[model samples]
Target: MTTTATAAPGAHLPEHLDFLWRSPEPEKAYDVVIVGGGGHGLATAHYLARNHGITNVAVLEKGWLAGGNMARNTTLIRSNYLWDESAGIYEHALKLWEGLEEDLGYPILFSQRGVLNLAHTEQDVRDSVRRVEANKLNGIDAEWLGPDEVAKVCPIVNVSSDIRYPVQGATYQPRAGIAKHDYVAWGFARRADEAGIDLIQHCEVTGFHVGGRDGDSVTTVRTTRGDIACGTLALCAAGHSSTLLDQLGIAAPLQSHPLQALVSELLEPVHPTIVMSNAVHVYVSQAHKGELVMGAGVDSYVGYGQRGAFHVIERQMAAAVELFPVFARAHLLRSWAGVVDVTPDASPIVGRTPYDNVFLNCGWGTGGFKATPGLGWAFADTVAHGRPHPLIAPFGLDRFVTGALVDEHGAAAVAH
Candidate 1:
């Protein structure tokens, strides 16, 4: 693998880019075939070679690498949740983010500047405090901060009593922060490429040919490139998982919704730590380039469009100005939307389907970016052993059937 100088924080992309991965043609067959070339798929391919010694792999993307939801996330990373299962997987991902740069031999710009999930009402305070305690019990760093402390951490926030949603308190995780999303994806892609895993782009999987004694295994993956036989298949496609599942004649309990986010023009550093207000429906973090990256809840309707309703963006900007009064003057630079596959429980589905040799890792909703590394590790293990990894056993498709959902709607710090 080639080593390059770490880009300075918030620096613009270099005029010339390093060749990260190869653009290879699809092979006739492979030991394992993964659909999706976003962070999860790339990370899974990297670990499949580094951990399990499985190199005969192919990751197929409908578009360019990381061009889907991976490119359109707010880039907030945290693991403080109300439930044990939620805490486990997310905290694991936080640990991986801490050392991802060193492990990948690449610069990911992972900044652990801390995160504050704000509480506005009495009930919000109670929930935030309970989540903090739950995080401590699980050996994760967490704390409860009052309005004054919240101001000390982020002075620009409007913590006064006159606001519609006055600040009561917040759950603070000192280890939680943000990273350069594209850099993280490139780091994983480069390593997987170095390991000889095929990162094929512009190759959409149209359908699958299933054949086995019980007719429950995928024999070939029909893609735009051509049909390729596979020993096993894994679906890591985020928003389009349901569409792909439909091709296999499998009913998935997943709904796709548009999640919108926007950034302000570059300016001097004004925001420090990450601040998220679920009650008001706004989350804000200043990027390395000095832009205020902000996002809110998903659109109510189900749609595959990569853009959101104007009313949603208007509401998000209104919430931002109310919380951070200073942002009222900040000019809107650009905005975008990413389709997310949400489940009823607001948790990811990461396990087996009816097909014996096919696996799934979807239904992440708005929290997919944070779970990339952790999910990649567990999903790769699950695909290698042909069983649900213990870390992801509770997230199988049978959960909906058996009433074993890992519900995280309230604790997720965002509306699902």
Candidate 2:
């Protein structure tokens, strides 16, 4: 049976009471309205209040909090990119990950176990060398390790020449690792709520009410529950970014695709660090509970369905066994997929749209999870000051026409 209770306004609930017990109903107007409640959106709201004192905010989610891509990734973190633009933003996120737990006052289980991107062929070696050099130039910590060094770092990897894709060498980032994905979302959500930011779930945005000169401003948002007037509207929707933008008669350069990941039954710890192989199309790291968290490339076609084909899973399993032959006997626990928004250049878009008051932070492709804190920090700065932050200005939508894309396809395509 459903139970209801009432308390005096502004009264704090007991510690044992659920956080949802005191959640306020959505207000009719807000200074800022965030259209998605994933990690990025929640983080944006938190920073908006914590950094800028913009507490009159609303975060609208179509489903339960953190139920989207925030909960559906393999949880790998890294900042070793080839370009300066990509390196700067992602490296910013890596730094934030260092102090995030203390900042949020929540346990996120961020482990700096290191990440190894294995190279197999001659081209892979060349790419690794170039990327490590560029990363160093951008003040990112990166190193190219030979096969012998790779084996020392990760003792179980099959560096033998007999494998389908031999591990010729690898690029290692000692700071790159994995964190608890769900905890990341919940931590931000809890902190945002504590700062009086409304987190409205099960509220789907139906259309946008655009007004002002040439309809360049979004005055209100029409959602399933009701209309909400807002001074500024920020779109942080991941795969559904294009759908929501289309309601405003704006088109985003994004395509939605399914990215698959799986976990194996719990076992004793054997994998010491995160391992990824682009040639074999697989990447893996052992979870805190000893489950082997694994993933590969995205599906070839566009899909809104949160599932991939069996053949894709089959190929990923083949690749996993090819790299770590000891994983051949591990039983599968669960497998699932999340819809990711892809762009032509394989980088994120995080700036103002053509609209005067509407901003977008989509096109993260398959790498959005690692970029959550950085995206939120820059996006909140953009929405607060009506200008893109210097760190993310290079990712503006104007780049598509100006032909100044910060293409990171070589690093972002696989093993995000």
Best by TM-score: 1
Model 1 accuracy (lDDT, Cα): 0.87
Tell me each candidate's TM-score.
Answer: 0.95, 0.94
- The per-residue C-alpha lDDT of model 1 at residue 77 equals 92
Per-model C-alpha lDDT, please? 0.87, 0.86
Q: Write candidate 2's Cα lDDT for 62-175 as tens digits.
A: 776767788889999998888888888899999999999999998899999999988889989988988899889998899999999999999999989887778889999999
* Clashes in predicted model 1: 1
Q: In candidate 1, what are the lDDT values of residues 4-26, reduced to their tens digit?
A: 11212333323344466677888
Q: Count steric clashes of candidate 2.
A: 0
Q: Which residue runs of candidate 1 sit more than 4 Å off their true CA positions?
A: 1-18
**lDDT value for model 2:** 0.86
